[model samples]
Target: MVDGRRITRRRFLQDSARAASALALTAWGLEGARGTASAQELSFPVERGASLRVLRWSQFVTTDRPIFEQNAARFTQRTGVPVRVEYETWTDVQPKAAAAANVGSGPDIVIGFFDEPHLWADKLVPVTDLAQYLGRKYGGWFDVCPQYGYSPQRNAWIAIPIGAPGVAINYRVSWVREAGFDPDPARFPRTTDEFLRLCRALRARGHPTGFALGKAVGDGNTWVHWCLWAFGGRVLAPDNRTLTINSPETANALEYARALYETMIPGVAGWLDPHNNRAFLAGEISLTNNGISIYFAAKNDFPEIAQDMNHAVFPVGPVGRPTELHLFSQAYIFSYTRYPNAAKEFLRWIMEDTQYARWINGMLGYVSHPLRAYTNLTVWRSDPKALPFRDAVARMLPHSYAGRPGPEAARAMAEFVVVDMFADACTGRRSVRDAIRAAEDRLRRIYRS
Candidate 1:
């Protein structure tokens, strides 16, 4: 984690008070057909000589970085705003953003993942004007899009969600058939019981699967949350105030995670996010949970592996429904930005169909659009392997699992409470009861004050 991102309660309340003014201007109405903010209303004219810097996580699909840099250069070409793009690991992105948000002195815009905005919405500029403008120009956002960035206290978006990377099972078709399971993507294992059996068969065939069990902010959290929700467990009460992580359903899920980890290749209890990506690419395993980045990596570097590998929906739980955790790609324009209008202008340019479509094509299937209209981007339909993930952003629930998001939900995600619970049980670090109790205790502290 980036150093010094933690928020003390006194500091947090202070920032929330400071953050209210930005929201107060547009707080009157946020839901249903609202009037758009014109370039004139958002105020500052695009400062011609202004320079804007955006800090973002390193690209998931790898190839998108250079393509994005090229796009940034093009943005500068059209507008006079000079742009500099910086990259960080997914693990480092939020903390760095937190550091910047608290200090009010970094990145004109920063890439935010999980619930970063929820944690520091008070410190970030409201983007409702920009969001609504984009919605009017390019069609509206998906139903879930606003929740990731919306500030109920302010009644505005803390950040405009750009997109999300959907988490799903990435399996080798050839290996599945070799292990005596149907290789057909359409007929792949749909239930948790069938998924477990297939993993056993694949393991016996010497292609054991694994997922990151360490504090992988994205991969570990997404898969663990999926398992927990699949088994009828959730992290928060409907109130978003009470901690509901310790339950019989949660224990059942933990038990399932323990069994699932046993089917994985050894040493997964120590793996990080990139470790499994490297493992799968090295042909060390047959199946794992991941986004389309793995697919692009295989296609670009290991064509034969690409041919063998394909995507599948996250397996259904015993509850007869599947739960997917979408790792969102959201960017915030900081309140401290000197070039607010220029920064907003740059984002608007980036969202335009021509610019955004080109960028989406370059990413392959790594990111799905936050808005429903952009679902027609054709990147998914062009590649059959990517089609399964087209609806990732549309189907996601908040990390808190219930009710509106807040600092409490964001803190729970950043702390990786659910992930640690499963890892504790799976790795023998703690019994299920002890693990759940430990998680509950930690959450109590997070939700306090």
Candidate 2:
């Protein structure tokens, strides 16, 4: 057992491969459009003798990879097109996908993180037909769903908004109870002011808490972004034309993070996505923000911790509602595919009701309902433990906040601008005003271009 809490391979490598695609795209650059047509008539990819390739991030929920492969195998049986599937760590998927887009060859499809479809809109074929088909089969898209893949500029869907994996506050129930709060995860805390108070209490009881402060490909930037929006702050206004991050609400959020930093583990300044999962499982931390992988890991490897842990929505902020920016777990069909029809067919099948239910059941709460209609899957109602993560899509705010998610917002988040702003203040690299000024300056430059 590492650090006295048993660590499983799932917890260890889940995000190991999730959500770094856009960051890589930022450094190397390339990332998609929106359409909602339901016509599936395709003439290319010659249905007979066509083979397909699919590449996706290896999931934190260990069961997810195998579940997808099983469905792919079933698709091959049904369609006679042999499918080749490969899994990359989340970090590698972006760069690899970018390379494919750069050369105009490789996998027919990919699963990438948020705004990624926007980043590579120029290189992707619009999946309006597939998206519209699924939305009708399931319920209509979640509010932020269209923003992820559909761009009004091109009047097409550059990529499909497959699903979103939401991040929330994962904590040890026993520790919170010891801290004098009710043990129920739902009642834990729903406001920033109270969340900080809970952190101090847990720290006093010997289980120091944390979320990554460094540029964690996923978790680090996620929590930082949460704090920003919680206090009536946003990186951009609704129009996407003006920068709106330098405000009193933004400063209040940063100051709250500064206070939170003091109560966390000493090395969080350098921590990334996996650190919190490892820390919590090792019994080193009591609470933090993350997906359901923590409880999933504990259930399999550290049973006691499993019983003691649960995931919760972010506490209500000054806005008085959870402005959760659910992580993007979207799939895209690349324009380079010779088997475009076969690739689209595979996606359509995997997303259908029976197969979608099977895939989600395997991951349990690790993957939340991407579509509002898919919310009734047995996984949420079957297991009481999975209840808190069920409303992930419901709690979401588009990653761009009030602004439309497109090139400008995509560039800002991909480069981790707002994340750096909060990190700088917490790490003492910049005062609150300077950090906000620097972020605003950087965002203005991105939107101006």
Candidate 3:
């Protein structure tokens, strides 16, 4: 059964690749339409006699999995090649891939998060050449895509963003209205002082604001990065080389975070991503910052709460309103893949416009096309059911910031700064300043080691 919207083959492969690269183009200050390559340029000499194995997030595939069986059947029929897909979660997949690489049995294709390229640098094949190939086949790379997964020092494209989960403020419109507040743009809090006042007002009216502070890496790290940006703290220097988390601005940010923590629900320190989502869904909290997936998850399971919840662009911080653009688990090809060309072709196929629509729509609205052009589609941009989310993305894109690129630094920040310090501050085990200072010391030790 055809499950999603479809586009022509040429439009699927060629146009999509060009569109994907558009984000990178804009980041580099380039201007042009995407996908101007002729069909002849995209025609590849097929090496049909190759077989490949792929490993991906286990939730996306299964052996007894009916979905995997169906998709694999179609893939084999289309390519005339044997294919195997192994599935595992991020925690399981990384160690498995590492162990497999050591034993020379790693899968040909690997799907990992944006940090994976940096985390598994030794195992990755710099697919930076894919940009050139995309240019030849489609037209040119987008401004944002290249930046998301490329490492300049490594001179390789270790990963490609298949999707992006933009962050935003999720609030209950019903509660806000009942609390005698108009949260419209003109009246919305734009500064930290105003935000605090609003939170106090909401609290007086019995609406507690929720911010993710759980011990899980996903929510905890997100809290640190988003709060830091909101408070005008720089995680790294402009050159992407220096750790600037110990700056005065960072201290100020941490202080603000501590104050905000004081106003949050009592047990927020123990709540992870799902816990925060549940808090909002169960009407325990009024406002929180989270990924678009939370909305999808809510809408899928509980339509009543979904209708009451609305999304807004994160309030502008002292420096500016900076939202986190989270690049979730993405796909990559392994250097050890025996059929690199075929693997690339498979990637190209899946990323093609038609197949992309299937993958995305099938995911119950959890995924978003990373490119602006694709995001401009009717389903993404104009759907009435998604208007709030679409508006959130539009407002966030210009001011979006990414955390430290590599997994090592990101993990360190999560383990040290977020889980240890921030969580402690929330729970009153340590003051914010002391926690941040301790985190800085811990980070220095980590990097030095």
Candidate 4:
């Protein structure tokens, strides 16, 4: 155990992969759709003898896999196509995807996280027609959807965004109340300064907060990026050309980060994505930022904690409005797949309102929709605590914040440039100024290429 807490996988992943688990599309079926009317008639003939292998991140919520498998079974029973779905730890998905792209063989379809499609756009089959049809039929994509799925270089959609696993503040109501702060959403901290005060107050009561500072792929990146942008700090200018991370705003963010870090439970500097989740469930941390997984786990395993837990959106910072970052998952077909038509059809079938709604509802509020119409889904309002996550996509800023989307932003994030900057200062390895300067230098090398 690290820091007297057990390190373990989310229990859902253990049994989900073994659960029991579709459709063929003719090449012309997707291509023929010019509008919503034609889209309804889309019966992409499944390529004869087509079978698919799909790789996705492990389920963060318990019901996610069974419902997903049930949907796949429905697709197969209806369309006479077979599908095999596999799961990997989320952090491992990127390298496995890279291997698939490099060797031209692996899972036929990969459902992975943020900007992965951008990293290998040239090697994937374009789904622009399918994307367009879905857009017309399902209202329209969110503002950040195209930024991740549509490739500027290819002038097409290399991937389809499935949903975002919304991240927000998870805290114990009793601890928050005892710490002398109201636990109500409306009464929660509304500014970064107030947030720091809350953290400090919680610590004074022996219930310190925690946020990842290590090289965690999801949690680490989400919270750090939010902190950076919340104070108006950015890696590049609006043109996406000039390096601008060394400014006063960034220094302010780092100084603030250092203060927050002081109020955190010990050992956060080495905490990974799952660390805070474990600590929170173990009742070692009074507060932390995470997706809905923590609440579900507590609901099932520790009823007392679950009863006292509540969620809220991050407070507004110096930049003024909400500036949160969430992990977005998207699916793409490798060009080498022998069943491209079947792959396209499977994606389309699952994203259809019927199957998509079932899959999303099963996740409860764990996953937020990328399509605008899904904002009205019943799951968002299923529980009062789920309400904060309902607008994650709508409230989020894309990677690189004020700058454009491209490989530079993806590369910087993959390398943990932002997370490490905060780690450096908070851990006392570097002063706040040095940490900002180091981040600026690293970003310059990345954006210059």
Candidate 5:
């Protein structure tokens, strides 16, 4: 929690107003004049010789190289400064960053999933003064972008959210229709019981449900968290300092997950994240929990499947609330870099409405933006095929929750809790109750240590 003294409601409202003003100015074509003045106020004046070194995810850097390069070129055109990028995978990024922070030799900026903030907090330079910087530059920060990467305790901006991927139930429209069920939202599952009955009905017709049960990190972690949320359980307490998975809600969630497993495709227990995508592509599974990445993959690589693919919000639980929506808003910035201001400026540039749209459209379905301004852009809103995803984003954005934003919490989740108990529960090797208890125990030990 943030210290009450540092974040009074008066200050929050004031900052929000400034952010709104900045956004309005940007929309009104004051980019160069406004940004320059703002930049001057925030930093020691853009040194004509100043440059930036940034670290980013390899896949995005590679595929979107041209777009980013063009954006970089434009930035140079506008500000007479240059930006350099170094890219790596999440697996390789941490060790390299840790080594750099150890030796004081890291890049100025870093891009990573939500887990990155918690993993690299010590090295990070809090932009809690983000309002100050924004107030100086363009008059304010963009309202929506800040929600993606703020740490209340540190009272700082850790990273800037570039894009978001939201979780939903992906299903084969034709298969569901053939099963004599309407896949429309109005007819969607309203409770766990209804979801199970539907899954059974699909299986009885020979279309198996599938989930990521493989040993891979992505699939395994997603399945565990989604189930935890859907069952009214949580990975940790609201303060994000304790693992409370042993509650009745958590046990029930696990039981619900186990029930889904029973109707999953044959050998699904052996499937990993990639395999889940393959299973869906091969037409062996009718439904699964997935994100825009899979939907985009289908749309681009397998058009036929994409044509048949449709997504719906996760089912509600017996408790009357809907499934927990897990949203991954990819953020950028690394603390070890010598060029924090430059990196921040670059982030600010990309998050602008114009640049944001280009990045979103170029992702070809790999990314989703959560901001209402971006989603309502003419490109996404005007397209019929994009409507389902657009609507899903709108509906799920409000309820979305992220994992703990601290290194200890992240390590516990990645190394102990997610990898262990979730695997055990899905394979029927442990009951939901036992899994939650064990996870909570492990997490307690992690927190204490």
Candidate 6:
């Protein structure tokens, strides 16, 4: 276990206030250099007769795709390079990107989830120049972005962190109040024990929470990682080489999972990414964790639910601070692409403040920006509901926190090692000791020295 004194309530609250507050765009005092300097400092020449194919994950909200395509069309019109954008279901992106990397031919660029570029760093083009330029132009990236974008093996940036459709606590306001807990972001439960009490109280009122336990690439792994790390459990030590998942801290987390699972709605054991969304929208679940997609859907269709829903960051655990894991997306160009220049330029064009701001505001903060300067965007401040999600990327612990991002971390996460370990304990499929031992064995093989 880690030193308990490492974090304190006073420190946590201080950090929470910083994260919850939306700082000004000029927070870095670079308001004058925002757009004009970027065009002058860096420019990629378009390759002749170049046509680009980009692969990205399918959209959760309908508006996201149209805005993306509109920006792509603008890129083509300005550069005379035709671009085609295709999407894969969230679960298929990693495997498909791996396959393309192995074959040396496919889409010129891929926008995939966290640490994926690390899994095939050698096969991807280094965007160090572009990444650094963006950082200087924007306020700079959040701390977690570099964990996904920079590859230690290559000593360069293998990907461009776009943004994260951050997962937050999605709860029904009335349900929380009925259970005698205030749903306000400031007044919500601050610790895991307090959170458990709220969950049990909700269950007693005939409303229960549900979190995915199945092989959900996004939701399942995200929450399970939070549960494990909440009590100071970590998959690997700081060296990124030592196996450290089986311990007293891990056992405590598993015991807590078992208790939390009891208060959840039935069949969470089989729940995938979409299950909780459906349940909550159907009024069968009183609380869950999700992106702004839930609120978006409710606003468009279920007005009453939209009015009643609220969001907050996950509760602090025994660790005395936030140890959250959210869905992060990054983009990478393939080494084998014929039009590397065209691909690079296209990426650069869309990430410019003009195009990026339009896309972000259109999506209404479904995807939290990785650049710190974006915290000042009107989208975050336009609606009170989106404010809780604005700094999620800034506050989250990336995959392999306390370690480094690499093929081992990516492979372990993709294989669902942590998710399954928590699932096994929560479902009573294995005793807590067995679950920890089994997870340790799997992690040992993955992180073999």
Question: Best candidate per lDDT, number?
Answer: 6
Per-residue lDDT of 255-338 in model 6, one digit per residue for the tens?
999999988999998887888899999999999989999999999999999999999888988999899888999999999999
lDDT of 5 by residue, 366-429 (tens): 4556443454555465544455455333443222233345565556645637546766787867
- Ranked by TM-score, top first: 6, 4, 1, 2, 3, 5
Q: RMSD of candidate 5 to the true fold?
A: 7.3
Q: How far is candidate 3 from the true structure (C-alpha RMSD, Å)?
A: 9.7
**Model 1: runs farther than 4 Å from truth?**
1-44
Please identify which of the two predictions, 5 or 6, would achieve the higher lDDT against the true structure.
6
Decide which is better by TM-score, 1 or 4: 4
| TM-scores of the candidates in the order shown | 0.89, 0.88, 0.78, 0.90, 0.78, 0.91
Cα lDDT, model 1, residue 329:
75
TM-score winner between candidates 3 and 5: 3
Best-matching candidate per TM-score: 6
Candidate 4, residues 84-173: lDDT per residue as tens digits? 999998888888999999999999999998888888888999998788788767766777777788777887888998989999999999
How should the candidates be ordered by lDDT, best one leading? 6, 4, 1, 2, 5, 3
Write the residue-wise lDDT of candidate 1 on 93-188 in tens digits.
888888887787889998778667777777777888878766655555665666676788766777878888888789989989998999777999
Q: Give model 4's TM-score versus the native structure.
A: 0.90
lDDT over C-alpha atoms for residue 144 of model 6: 81
In model 2, state the lDDT of residue 171: 85
lDDT of model 5 at position 74: 83
lDDT of prediction 6: 0.88
Predictions in order: lDDT: 0.81, 0.79, 0.61, 0.85, 0.62, 0.88
